[model samples]
Target chain A: MVQRLDYLKESPSQTAGPYVHIGTNPNWVEITGVWKDDLGLVLVGPETVGERILVEGRIIDGSGALVRDALVEIWQADAAGLHNSPTETRGTADPAFAGWARQPVSDADGLFRFETIRPGRVPFSGGGLQAPHVTVWIVARGINLGLHTRLYFGDEAEANSVDPLLNRIPDPVRRATLVAPRTERDGMPVFTFDIRLQGDGETVFLDM
Target chain B: MSGAYFQRDRDWHPPALTPGYKTSVLRAPRQALLSMPTTPSEETGPVFGHDVLGPLDNDLIRNFAKDGGEAIGQRIVVYGRVLDENARPVAGALVEFWQANAGGRYRHKKESYLAAIDPNFGGCGRAITDAEGRYAFRTVKPGAYPWPNGVNDWRPAHIHFSVFGHAFAQRLITQMYFEGDPMIWQCPIVKTIPDPAAIERLVAALDRHETIPMDSLAYKFDIVLRGRRSTLFENRMEGN
Candidate 1:
């Protein structure tokens, strides 16, 4: 017998509570000296490659109220369809791009924003190209476990049509919830992607 | 071009819509969760350098102290290892923690608890696991407090932990309860979990062996993250 120990079960998740900012982004809450700056504040520098774009959105609850306490994190590939991770076996991702950012929804506006380059099409594990998309993870006081979802570009209609993951959804109406339509703000490309926790037009939460 | 993938065990997690946890009623998704495979985006995560941590980043006792004052409470040392399901060490993982002070009061403006806040306790800390996947920190034993969830629902003393494994998919945010805390059974939030075994995994046992003599008691809590499938299975698929 190998005599290996049994695998340990995962720990139970709990709510992040209203003070999650104190731990994740202390500086945002005015607690200084924890770090020079909070991690994930900047995703791209001036030298980063690809189309510079901005992503903004709010997390709305089932009651149609904005969740001011929610924290949002995003992960995506670089413009060359490469990830800035050691696990990425493809070509090198943009050295200047971190490709990950965490932002807390502003208490005043209940909105979170990220400035980065448009991601390129990444390969689906099942062997086809996926639409250029950004993976989004959300946590808040009411949420016991973090919710997982993705944001697809509405402008990539041609690519979205054949995306393995997006096409898996049988209903086009539900699929539309994952697409963020592009709009211009002061000559800058902006994608507004709002996430609804429940009820009508609920986002397609992913189980990965 | 792809690596081994591990599926999340949804059954182990509490349902999103547990009514007892009042917040879940409105926040849980009504639609069934959609399933997907791991991608570069899911498998990759942000890398945090050690430069981000300061000298007192992991010592909550004096991290926020002013005028050389220490937090008021029973001092404790929390030690543990971050491991994968396969029992492999998950080194370089960032472990962030926060909790109420010894008086059961958080240092936040939104905290409604009437307990007095300790001037020396900020109640938050961070640590990066070593090559052995072990991490330790010193702090005061947090006090249990009441919440507005129910008429008299009181939460057990607990510390919140945020862990980041090598992959974004391995990120986890959870709480660690003290062993023998009867309130763990009474809390509506802890009740949401269907399995008692899973709940037990969240409880840290007192480690007398590791306790500092007359200095601080010790608690041990080992965290487990999702593991990758064996390479042999990937090889078989490639051959097929």
Candidate 2:
């Protein structure tokens, strides 16, 4: 039996290297020629519509080690419940906000921070509104595939209770993993979201 | 289960699922909860235009090579087309990659490998697919290095790839291993694909025609994004 060699086979999967930062966020790695700044760093300008908020948290691996090299990206709807995307036919998202961000877990403590507005409630496919939440994607050296999750605002308790996706999680404890605790720091609303990759308090990582 | 294709086998990936694999702390079990709907928010966009591109984005080798200072190792050209599962070209996809240096050490602070740092290579690059879905990069061959996975376990020579197609749902991230690397079979990462046919698809062969006479060698690696499989998530609203 002979094998065909016309198109090269796609390579096997490997974890993103420790230096994914250099590629994804070149400016952070000090690769100056790439761009003035990395993409998704400033998702919202001053004119962006939304209740601006500070989202911060650490990514803890199962062994309790901080995934220092982890990179986190988030996507969400603007305050008007509109998405900043070309596919959005319902309404235009705030022109000032891209509604997306890519943040690296800080080397000091594996904490990732994003400065953006609190996302507005968006609709589910069939009907009804989802909770005000941010879709998150996480990648690091040990993670073969990027992990997907969501962070709902703790203050949006009513919306959280009715969120279609949150209701999908069968277990209450697991559902709790999706909510971000809210607080006020420096006179601004802050949402603390800690993502646990594995173990007792493992975050609810969505398969998509 | 006829005609149903699960992307990964539990045994092959996240090695901890296999009894006694030893990296239990990092492994997350494949649960029914993972299967969910992908909403419009999950998508990257209608297209990834030049807005996301960086100045030195396309050429990975020269970005880190520092003014034509040749990085130490074998120089090779990696070129390929980004296509849909149906075999159509996917133009305007953002293709990005990073890898270890010739000595198998990354430019990361946490990397403690004793190998000498290639003052010339930063190991990162990004290129947008052309109208024909073609992309290319010039880089040094990466070396194999031991990891904490197990005793004597060394990663195979490979390049990490991240592609953002027309939409977020079309995004893919995978590694391209060198053809004929003996470590392909031994590495747990490669075995994770489960299907023998799928695993074979990952190895890129050397193209003598692509090789530059007295200058460098070339390798061809084409990446196929989802077409019909993407429909599976259309109603579901989540998960890539």
Candidate 3:
């Protein structure tokens, strides 16, 4: 197979702007502070009792087009269903559990792989419930236009059934894009998700 | 890599850091890293596009559709003010802007405005400095364009302002919103003007006889490139 590449002549790494890393948003600012993993974590669901699972995904823009050189940052609650809020979870003294995190850049295939334990269910406004998921942020072309979305356990059909945000996405296929993949691959339980940006197969984002 | 062959200097040399001072800043040596060339091309050719290859569907903001094409070599003036951190007037500074006309366009290929994508309005203009560091452009104002926000929203009629000498790292990229516009609140990047009259002050004040300072309809866009003082960070170990 031939590798697709930019014919700009010079290497992009040589031409890219300096200080491209302005900083991550507050959510991720809180994340890299604490909940981070050096090794890839297997994304486990309610059905699979995974001693080893690797949750991997590629984030695509609104047009379902791959943002080849994008950066995605994510952070979520641990498996215990607790957040790093002084009003909530402990580890307040420790610098790690900031409940925020960051990812520098996406790979050649526009893929970003995050290693983390399964997050627990969280509450939402108006009795609506947020499923156990990971919040994502995107920085592409050096501008940090914060993109907030979540990743949910697909194998957990019962949990997905009650999720308010997923239920409100309008289109079934569009809603399905938000679900994380859970299946056996190469002798390991692996969750594969391809997060889509705007238009079809996408998640919601705030104005901020 | 070819870059590795270049001579390396490990010595650290820096002047005493000072706040609100230009001497200390200009003296600051350029980084070892290659600096991108930002020189504006002085070539002023037949800038307006000519329908030489005939019109195509892929192109927008076609200026060459008519005879002799759109107005090229049109000279205009730019008038605007300068505001400090608290949005106060910083009387003496330099403000310069380079952009295409009302078509929301640019001479450069990499423009982000949608008006450039439109065939109707051709946006292009540039403003130079004045005594008060005020700047103005001699062109029709640009129209608000729609962006693909989660929900569709139109950007307010605005012009970008670039400022210099305010401080190091004071390179600000800001757009001016037309006065009395409702969309200002909805814009994600627009830091709201606390005062209702802020917009009016930013606009050309007709009664103040400051109306139309230079060339065509004047727009007084005072800018503070930097938000006052900020540190020029240098990484070092504890002892150093």
Say which prediction, candidate 1 or candidate 2, comes out ahead on TM-score. Answer: 1
Q: How well docked is model 1, in DockQ terms?
A: 0.66
TM-score of each: 0.96, 0.86, 0.37
Candidate 1: regions farther than 4 A off: A1-5, B233-240
Give the higher-TM-score candidate: 2 or 3: 2
Error of 2 at B219 (Å): 1.3
Give each prediction's DockQ, rounded to 2 decimals.
0.66, 0.39, 0.01
Question: What do the candidate models score in CA lDDT, each in turn?
Answer: 0.87, 0.73, 0.40
User: Compared with the true structure, what per-residue lDDT tens digits does model 1 show for residues B1-240?
Assistant: 446447777778777889998988999998998887677778887777777788998899999888888999999999999998778898889899999999899888788799998988888899999999999999999999998889999889999999988888888888899999999999998888888888899999999999999899999999988777655544232423
For residues B1-240, write the lDDT of model 3, one tens digit per residue: 000011111111111122122222221222222211110000000011112112221111222223334333223233565554434454334332323455534333334665443323233222333445454444445555554443565555555443333221222233455556776656533422233343343343322344445534433445543232122453334443
Q: Write the per-residue lDDT of candidate 3 for residues A42-61, one digit (tens) a residue.
A: 23334432244456777655
Model 1 alpha-carbon miss at residue A39, Å = 1.2
Q: Kindly report, for each predicted structure in the order presented, the TM-score of its chain A compared with the true chain A.
A: 0.96, 0.91, 0.64
Question: What is the full ranking by DockQ, best candidate first?
Answer: 1, 2, 3
Off by over 4 Å in 3: A1-19, A22-53, A62-64, A87-99, A142-144, A185-188, A206-208, B1-240
RMSD of 2: 5.0
For model 2, state the Cα shift of residue B136 in Å: 1.2
